[model samples]
Target: MQLKIVLAVLGIVGGSAIALAQTMQSNHGDGMDHVTHGQDKPADAFGLTEPGQGAFAALSEVVRFLEADPETAWSRVDLTGLRAHLVDMDRLITDTVVSETELPDGISALATGDIETRATLRRMVPAHAAQLMRDGRWAVEVSVLENGMELRVTSDDPAVVARIKGLGFFGLMASQDHHRKHHLMMARGNDVHAH
Candidate 1:
């Protein structure tokens, strides 16, 4: 519909805005590097290096096991990695807040002109989400307890999710296809941006 197009355009423009701010940082993973951390955000967890490398690395084995056993995919995966993987993203999003009183400890320089903290993050969301999409790994958490593994697509931060979804890369993984190791599962949102 027209609405989708308008949002898409706005998302593109928002990305441009970040570029204009010159605050967009690049830290792409070469797909081959399984255990490395982004220079932007260093490894604060186990010696795992990359935030969720262990979880993503486990996907191939999980898929192979699933292919071998028709019904054991959910049971065979080392659920710890996937759960821990999503948790890392959750922590990152939670730590990202747009507050007038508090600028994120190390990101103030990324601010555009004289904008306030919230406005700066709002302007930066599109670019940040895109960057996160490129580097942040996601998965469909499946298990034997019920029938599937589900994450609350919508994060606690609506604004951040909206920006991510607006980028069209949202919902990158809302399916059961385990063939590909990385699922670009998106953060859900009620997008309200207009072109």
Candidate 2:
């Protein structure tokens, strides 16, 4: 009788442990670890997505270039280059229009800077075809052809968000100057762009 009771207790404990392990594994999504899950996949992933590879790639390249040499990046923006980039972005955004909820206070701060800086941002953010301003830190809704891409930028100050929204890659470069250190750029897929 004593032996049977000990075996039963051991069996129950082992079964509980296995069940807990399975639950944890499922939560992690096959051990891949999902950072976010949304309704619509990102535009870049969508096949018919208009903001095709060229548009996104150009933006990425511009961002990288600016990040590498922020001081002189603006100087490189000529009328022709700007127009070409804008055209590509326009193509992408026409289909991927994203709506934003509320603009964050920090993003509003960009308006406080000098006339030139403020003016630059005003012209640039819209020119880059950003759809709307949202409540998250460094947050903005971007439209593409097939779907929209929600870009969430997190930073402590409005200056940083303004710089990035206005300058794109160059703004990210400027962020390095700030005291709050982490610079995270997240591009989500699915309904992640919606809300």
- CA lDDT of each candidate? 0.35, 0.40
lDDT of 2 by residue, 1-195 (tens): 999999999999999999898887767654254665423676345354233465455455445545666464354443344334345334333422223332453222222123433333343344332332332345543322122133334456777555455644323323333211111111111111111
Candidate 1 Cα errors over 4 Å, as ranges: 1-68, 71-76, 98-195
Q: Which stretches of model 2 miss by more than 4 angstroms?
A: 1-21, 36-53, 70-195
Number of clashes recorded per candidate: 1, 13
Clashes of 2: 13
State residue 9's C-alpha deviation in candidate 2, in Å: 25
Kindly list the per-residue Cα lDDT of model 1 for residues 85-190, writing each as its tens digit.
4444343334433222112211111212222323323433332333333433321111111211112222334554453344322223222233134321211111
Cand. 2 TM to true fold: 0.22
All models, RMSD in angstroms: 24.7, 18.9
lDDT of 2: 0.40
Best by lDDT: 2
**TM-score versus the correct structure, for each prediction:** 0.20, 0.22
**Weakest 10 consecutive residues, lDDT, candidate 2?**
179-188
What is the TM-score of candidate 1?
A: 0.20
